[model samples]
Target: MAGSKIVVRFAIIVAIFMMPSLLWAGAMEIESDRMVFQHKSERAEFISNVHLKRDDFELWCDKLLAYYKNSQLDHTEAFGHVRLAQKGITGSSDKAIFDQKNNRLTLIGNAVLEQDGSRITGETIIHDMRNEKTVVQPRKGGRTHMTIESDKAAGTPLPKAAK
Candidate 1:
């Protein structure tokens, strides 16, 4: 009766004290000007200069929605002026989805990806982070374009033999 209620209250207090330790575990750091998290819904929404960072890569967007499973980040959706930058690659798009476990990122709407000064533009682009591979597809009425740049000028000749 009364004893049971008191025991429940003590348990609740202990659980609340442990929350911070369990909040962010084994996941990237996510920051935004505003954020809302609904634990029961397993979703977190962020707006205004949304940013996500994990290791050397970074993602930025106007809005971001993150889904969680067992407190682990499952995936994320970024919308509006999405941008991603990594060591050897950079990308821009209107929208993007980052799959955490698969280490894949898919961008849509005027997607652009650049690597080693080479660029690809299309309606959609899929990048494999682990393998460093990319695929691009055109919109219904558009076409994809890829251009590679040479390091040296075409007219440049090998340097004369060193003295």
Candidate 2:
């Protein structure tokens, strides 16, 4: 009877350890040409066609690094030709950061974000998925442009162009 109890206890421990992975089946995985993870306790390196996938978003870049503490993902950074795509929206930049808790994504260095038929280009970009909005700001001496072409105003009065 003692042997049976030991077996049951072992099974329970195994199941408990597996529960987290099963619950977060949608956790993001990143891949790229090169990747490096440096943490206080551990470090990892990766290479070749880096790609990251989560519940709804995917990222492809040249390199990526993930930091951790006590086994929790502290933060993640991607460098060199980073591209992020999700739900028909795509963004490109030199660097990108993903903040898990705040659920925020920030793209920097000559960033361009495109969604539907609209595109925003600037030196910095911030996307707040929780609020469904994006902010783009260009660098100094740069111009921000917004163009809308529609068929509804085929004969509408138009403003004269400044010469």
TM-score of each: 0.75, 0.68
C-alpha lDDT score of every prediction, in listed order? 0.77, 0.65
lDDT digits (tens) for residues 21-103 of candidate 1: 45443336666777666767777788777777877888889998887665566788999999999888899999999998788
Model 2 quality (TM-score):
0.68
Worst 10 residues of 1 by lDDT: 2-11
Local lDDT at 10 for model 1: 15
Residue pairs in collision within model 2:
31-50, 31-51, 32-49, 32-50, 33-48, 33-50
- Model 1 Cα shift for residue 102 (angstroms): 1.3
Off by over 4 Å in 2: 1-25, 32-45, 149-163
The pairs that clash in candidate 1 are: none
